[model samples]
Target: MTDQTDEEYREAPSDRTHVKRYHWLARYDQETVKAILDATPLAHVGCMMNGVPFVTPTFFWREGDRVYWHGSSAGRMFHALEHQDICFTVSMLDGLVIARSAYNFNCNFRSVMLLGRAELIKDEDEKAEKLRNFVNGLIPGEWERLRPVYPKEIKATAIASMSIAEASCKVRTGPPIDDDEDYTHPSWAGVIPIRYQVLPPEPDPRNLPDVSMPEDVLKFRLG
Candidate 1:
């Protein structure tokens, strides 16, 4: 992300992340990559285990310039990820574009891909604090009122972290571009906008008579 022009950044930190087609839509700046990852609520984690490839979907969380995700300590994904090369990606599809020609059809989206190895947080106290931050980050005030985490539960979970140092983002927006001759073809051409919204929560039927939705849940926003 340094020693390069905006255009060069698009091509990138390495050939692996370089944008080949539609290179103009790519961005290598730290801000753009971070924002794209933050906007997407989930990150697809990829790694290899026992000579087989695996991609696990997990909640995405960013702290400072790092990315984190958690799973069972004994899980295959976590076991394969520890200090091992891996890739994680996040994407948000914004709309669909209809072009006069079938070949010109495309989807509008923002996406990021990162490469690195995860460092397991071995310190119990630090891991506990990180979990607390992760919970409150997704839902403010929820962690404060929750029951204390048991020692066994902490022992059973694994939290992995890696700096968002090597990554690239590609984003496409606006309407489709069709050949000049195709403009008069009388075919419908426009965008079908997509929206991501948080709907009203449905409380569990088993809640106690006096139980009610918490204020934190009311104001929660995924980012």
Candidate 2:
């Protein structure tokens, strides 16, 4: 945890929330953190088990100030995460910054790091609702058309929720910054932008002949 002066400490302290390196890029605003989380569906969760650090990649969704993820109830990783301290992080690479000098190379990205403990969502009704929201949120109206989650499926899965007790977002955008002398260098330098695009949806071979893609699926776009 980074040390903070008395006045610098937040009312609700998340001791490790501060970004010590490249502090200029750190953003503590709730909206900023939420934006990064909302833009990325994949998250990496880190935790310790048997004195060994483990990081697992999983799909996640955010609602208000809380984040949720689901996994097999029998999985050791989820077992270790439930009711235990964890760090969740999401990052999206936007571009590569090519500079005249190697030392000035950088990446344009948006990222968020959160520190908190996850609580197991054990209530059946609440879990069902959250699962429905997860499906509908990702592709609106799809949940209604799909088969309902069975009680056995719910029993086999574990949903975990972690409040955004302490979080920070870091974003870097625009062009590369090279030394004054590097401006005259022979090498070309600029930002090579990267973006994610939605490709045409492929249907299962066994699908009914009359079925067509839904509007939400056709219009789906990543942030």
Candidate 3:
């Protein structure tokens, strides 16, 4: 965990009633929050343009409790996100938690919804560091292996970052809740675990004969 002073902490008005039964899953430990943030590859950010609203999915990375994403400076999302209120969500499904009753079926998953202000990163050095973080967050040890970004590329792309202060995390685990009457009903109920495994890399026909896949990426594990 990163060290922080008291002044850096902010309490969200929405986090007041965290453990209500209806939103029981919304209460998460710090480790759970970090795990969900680290494992997610993409996030959807919702924002409004004039009277219309939009939800756009894009790649993101987490640094502490902040979420960062980027795109072309002239892109629709990038333009709209600047100086606006945004809500971002990331989710990962682990399995199905089955129960004996029809209403007892539940899902084993982790998700996060963040509310904050989004703005463009204008500093050159900070922009470069954030861009590298976004690329490496998906695959460890990838940023250093890739070639340096061209000057034109930096000028063309825009990076935006939002604080995750006013955020809520929800997770569902274990078996489902069955009705009292359903307890006497005979039915098989259990959980089915899910996982993602990487397939062998496929080479492109136009690639050089000597080119090969990197071991780090080829053997990457989701677990």
Candidate 4:
């Protein structure tokens, strides 16, 4: 239930997860939600600290029904998030919808909003393994090529995870929808498509000149 592994659409676990405005664009299915989450490595986690709300941007990864993010252990955000209710959200814009009217102008996008409580991965070993997975998940085989992570390094970082059981996916696509009479107007109406690209690798100056890009590095692609 957490991972949205089932093919059938499910109901929102709570009213908060349901999409209200533009309700037709809201999706309550596991597959759709999971896809949106996997499409982006970045997300914002909204949490409360000392009664003040804070939204922290983080690089996140998903495994099964859970997602994880990290920050410096000494940072107030991580410590403030422990065992707290959180709103985790990811969004990627695919295109710009140019409409005949300003009101109809919008973005073609896919996004997921997740509701859950945050938990810390307290076990050092598990945390370290998950950290390794994060590096390799973004760049395959990159973790192995780097120096081993120090025990102190692990201690200095905080890993937070949240379940994805209660989540909603919202998406908008295709051309803009304008007033019925706007179709006869001279203004153009269409989508300006956008996409992500993997550029040529830029090696660091400190790297040995003889060192070449690893095969796995070349194999990396944005999901």
Candidate 5:
């Protein structure tokens, strides 16, 4: 795990962080924002390209107040990311709130939006270390068992990190909120819970007969 210092986190909010609608759902605490980011792995990164908007989905991880993501060195998206300001967002849907009236229908979810400029990590050693952290953090003990990352492989990837400079978390949960008159309607209303499940690992057919699943593989879980 990456060591986080007190200075890395602070209650700093920007004009864009304020939630105008449903202001009660906004969360500004650093810890709360970090929790949402940690629970979600996929982030939709939005940036400008040639004076036009562009968004790309990629796997990401958080360490302290910084978020890191990588892509092929040959990708134009990576090139654009390094030179422009970006918005990174992660969201997870928890359930559907079915209400008597269509106007009252909503979904429960947790999400975070961060805005910052990405700094390309150019040091080879630093890149290797961060890459290892990403892999081992996702699957404990897996990095050591796999073949070492080659220099060519490292050279073929572009890794970048962005500070959690301006960020906010918004969440909506609990039962449906309907008008008093709508409650008496014939239609039913409640929350349909949703959860993520991890299935048993499937081994490759070419594996040796004596090989078996590792302890980490059997205990893998996701939020």
Candidate 6:
């Protein structure tokens, strides 16, 4: 993900005032937002169909709370949300955001779960715009280089929008936790920062011999 200015992101605290069970709605920090979005690839989108609740984890690209996804026009998940209410969630775990106390120990993460109704964005122009957002989010400049979506491609897929209404953000960070008695034990106790990166890209064998990886995608330092 591109480095973002602090002012570019915003997360609001949940309405719950008590920190019981999981204080999911208690924290609204920028670090929390970045950690979650940067750490994971899949997002579980919730929707209701025929009075039954359903959730499907699919490939997603997030821009703030607004998420865009496309799939076969006939798929169950896509069909279910074609004209219904839906919710989307994106989460990423960056190592263990743990601490030295039971209450303090927490996972380092940034996750945003949103609720809102969805509607198929039938406007051809709008659909094209959303598609660009998804491609850019995955690997910048891909949409321009890859073949443009054909009119048939658009007709064969379903694209929709979900308003980011009520959302909850939670996060945890720091070192490992130990009981009062265990705290005195001499043991290593700090986080080992985890990282992910993309190796050199491999070209498809069927391609006419010599296409190198794109600079935009190759420049990524996956963590």
Best candidate per lDDT, number?
4
Q: Which residue window of length 10 is worst by lDDT in model 2?
A: 1-10
Please provide TM-scores, in order, for all candidate models, with all chains considered together: 0.93, 0.91, 0.82, 0.92, 0.91, 0.72
* Clashing pairs in model 1, backbone N/Cα/C closer than 3 A: none
| Candidate 6 lDDT, 106-162, residue by residue in tens | 555556666566667777778788888777767888899888789888777778666
Q: Which segments of model 5 are wrong by more than 4 Å?
A: 1-12
Please write out the lDDT profile of model 4 over residues 53-164, one tens digit for every residue: 8988999999898999888989888877765778899999999999999988999999999987888898999999999999999888788999999999999989999899
State candidate 1's TM-score. Answer: 0.93
lDDT of 4 at 6: 30
How would you encode candidate 2's per-residue C-alpha lDDT over 34-126 as one tens digit per residue?
Answer: 889898689999999888999999999988889999989898877888657899999999999999999999999999888888888989889
**What is the alpha-carbon lDDT for the whole of candidate 1?**
0.85
User: Ten consecutive residues with minimal summed lDDT in candidate 3?
Assistant: 1-10
Residue range with the least summed lDDT across 10 consecutive positions in model 1: 1-10
Number of the candidate with higher lDDT, 1 or 5: 1
Give the CA lDDT, 0 to 100, for residue 158 in model 2.
87
Scored by CA lDDT, what does every candidate get? 0.85, 0.84, 0.74, 0.85, 0.84, 0.63
Which ranking of candidates, highest lDDT first? 4, 1, 2, 5, 3, 6
Q: Per-residue CA lDDT of candidate 5, range 1-223, in tens?
A: 1232333323348776766666667777788888888886789999988888988999998988899998998887788987877999999899999999999899999999898889888888899888998888788988898889999989888998998868888788889888998888999899998977778888999998997878988877664
Model 6 off-target regions past 4 Å?
Answer: 1-20, 29-35, 38-41, 50-52, 63-65, 82-85, 97-106, 185-192, 221-223
Pairs of colliding residues, candidate 4: none
Score candidate 5 by TM-score against the native.
0.91
Clashing pairs in 3: none
- Cα error, residue 61 of model 1, in Å, equals 0.4
